[model samples]
Target: VVGAGPAGMTAAYYAALKGHAVTVFDMMEKQGGIARYGIPEYRLPKVKLDKELNSVWQLRDTEFKGGKMLGRDFSIDDLFTQGYDAVFLGLGAWRSNELRVPGEDLPGVIEAINYLRMNSEGNPVPVGKGQKVVVIGGGFTTFDCARTSRRLGADVTVVYRRSRKEMGAHYSEVDDAEHEGIRLEFFAAPVRFVEKNGRVGGVEFQRMALGEPDASGRRRPVPVEGSNFVIECDTAIPAIGQVPNLDFFEREQGVRKTKRETVITNGALMTDRPGVFAGGDVQMGARTVIECVAQGKLAAKAIDRYLAGDDMARVAEEIAEEEAVPELIDIVPYKPEEPQVRMPMLPFKERDLSFQLIENGYDKNAAEKEAARCLQCVCPDVGRCHLQRLSLEHGLTDNRFHRAEPVDYHDYEYDFSHDFILRDLNKCINCTQCVRICRDVIGANCYGLMGGGYDSIVTTPWNVSLKYTDCVSCGACAETCPTGALMMRERDLQTYELDIVRCIYCGDCVEVCPHGALGETPNFELSTYGRFGRTVLAKEELAVARTWKPSEEIPLDGHNSPRPPEIRPPGPPRWGD
Candidate 1:
């Protein structure tokens, strides 16, 4: 592995897991490349980063050689000669783009990447403490510099050529910088540096107007005629995008690279040379940390397959299919309104010269509450739901007792009534949270175990509508439900248009209503009335509901709350050993 960024570490991890002898070499002194040096301390602390990187160090037979750069210390052929089986190049995009404007070579004018890197180390750059700094560009790096300057007691201003919406930086970062008294001037592109006495004074900017969409699909910023302006300051920092630095890549090695300097690779991440693979920002230009990690992992797979003599093309196709965009399932889940748990941050008043971390990540309770609010749209409880997690942990992906026929899977209709809860029986994994919470916590005893064997399920007594039971509408059951089985409905009545053709006007719904949702109105008609909710009952549905007679075992103890019968397990698996 080369360049110990997120991608390199991830590749090293996967390679180590496969029992491969791995050695990570980086030009930097530390394991985390950008995550350690590039990002500011206030954003990502050194201790936390070190802790994460230490995991790779714990692996047996894996070695880390800091300051061992490619092309200088050793070449691709050199590694191959050293008995190494495979090489993964995770050289990240480190080299920041130059402004290419006049006076850019001035002393005070700096690149934000270098500034952040210097600050991250004990060595601080001289652009703070009574200095008026104007940062050019609007990206994470730009905000980082502006905010860092603010903390360093610099009167900072961020100038971008497009609207705030068009900025490449996250809105949260931009908002935080603005809140920290960092001025933001939009529709202004850096024209040149306003030199004063040779060193630097301020930056001259050109006012811009948005034009047709560029290749990126965002409106391109066009320079406005005669709209020249200058912001007087002591320093000018350009925090534009970065590109991969291939200074170490020798042409004699035969690895191809794009004009952007990103390494060109096949679908399997292999370069032109055999056994030479590249991934992360070095391959996919400048991307997110997660994307880099993903690239590293995929590259590891390709390397493993290559080593195992598998067809590279077939492996690439399978990987592409696995990583294909997931089909969008248009399933809307109802959830109660709850504000996100806010993470505590360092007070703005105390954010001067101190590199103390800003965000104090969510606590246990805060994390749990925030996690519980997830709609669990995909598998409902992907991260938070213990059932889903445990299923994955136990490797439940391939069930032991596979359904032999199409009739094995149960399909049940949904119940959207009861005002406060939604019941989608299809998603219920039978975790029994609802059964426990309703019976033990709420004491409403609305639900009980019904059916037998593999078909066992929790439902209201006799599978009656939740409103028919003594439900308090406290939403305890929905809250306790692990999956998207029972979700708390949005606090609104679902309007059901009355089909007059299907209405028999039998008034059975009005008679059997528990919440008094149906009753005589001022008009003295059998239409849906009262405040509980308006449910326009179809004559056919009413007929089926009317036929649902009370079982002899059911008792009228406030509700037809029938106690569940003793579960008698029928024998072991019929076919399994």
Candidate 2:
């Protein structure tokens, strides 16, 4: 097996599990391909990654060798000659895309991927302090480049050719840049770089406007004439996009190439050459990790079929059955909850010259609370939870009614910072769908379960408010909320109300309210004329009503007097006389 990324690793695991002797080769020192180097440790920590890597390494029949570059060290023919049954090419895309501008050859211009790789590998390069750095791109790499430059003591800024909403970077990442004082210039594209002393000293940019939708269905950025501007900077980083590296396959024997320089394969993932296959980034370009894993598994099964000399159709069906599992419950159609983690940062004065890790990881209790919010998208515990089903089967209603006391309404706080996803501690059932999505799917470990026993809850680092944590507003949490606790704020506004009863002494409401409006008291009393037309008496109105009484006699000429047309009864007076 070639490569050791998610797909390659998963393929090796499954192949070994099926009692096949597998040997995997990678160019890097570690097994986790892009995941180990491309992502930051703060997001996907080394510990968690180690756990996964170890599981794969423990496969008795699988072997992994690092520092082995294909084509350069050993060709595909060499592997076949070495008595290996077959070869699977999973080499990922590593070459970074260039800006292709005039001054891009200058000393200060660097590829964003290369820069990130160097940083991730702990390699020291020239990113001088007190220098101005500009990053061009709208993807996550651009943000990473900008933020990393900031840590290196450079005044960092991001220049994107599109609007903020169109940016490919995750929202939380963009928000982190903003929160960390990283300046962003939107609707701008790099025209050229200005060089001095054979090094980049500044950059010239062209203002761009959104044009008609292109083939990709996204509005293409078109340069506006006569809108060129220049900004002086010490360095410039290009993070436009990436493509597959097919140099190994191109030079290898009996390998067919596609028009796009990708590997050509038949129905069994076998190249035109027998016993040779390719998958993952080398086959699909730079895609998501999940896609890579899926490709790896498919390639493994195809290799097995080739070795067994079985019919491809039957083999494919068996592989599909192994991959597919039946769902016990159908979940309600819900959007993912927007992430609410926000990390408070150091003061501006402190940030100007520090390289400290800005956002801390979640603590034990905070991790649990945040994990509990996960929607657990593919889990079987959605509408037909075994606990709830069993309870109903036993005719249990209000199972703990005797022990249930009135919960302090004021103790429960609400977080509505993101357009989607609401956070209310009162309604959480402690299911961990949100946590799983954030960690496994989104590739952002922003949520986790924390604390012990009854004190436990899902939260971010330091038990901070979701609006102040490192959450990226992915909506995975709100999507998994079984109860109405965590919901999209935009979908339901009436759910937020200041109840007059059951308020405890806790001040959670004051702390968790992202908007101050929730805590502000208006002078207007609950009248039947407002939007909802529901009268809610204030504390003062209730007090006044308790002391009021009706008078014994009716007024004749006052506002409460009867009209003159109404005559009083004189018979009662005559009978009394």
Give the residue spans of candidate 2 off by over 4 A.
266-268, 313-329, 333-577
State the lDDT of candidate 2 residue by residue for 202-312, as single tens digits.
999999999998887879999999999998888888988777677656577688887666787765667878788888877877777789988987787788778888766
TM-score of every model versus the real structure = 0.65, 0.59
- Cα RMSD for predicted model 1: 20.0
On residues 451-470, what C-alpha lDDT tens digit does candidate 1 reach at each position?
A: 98888888889999887777
Deviation of model 1 at 287, angstroms: 1.6
Clash list (residue pairs), candidate 1: 376-380
Total clashes for model 1: 1
**Model 1: residues >4 Å from true position, as ranges?**
248-252, 328-340, 374-577
Cα lDDT, model 1, residue 297: 81
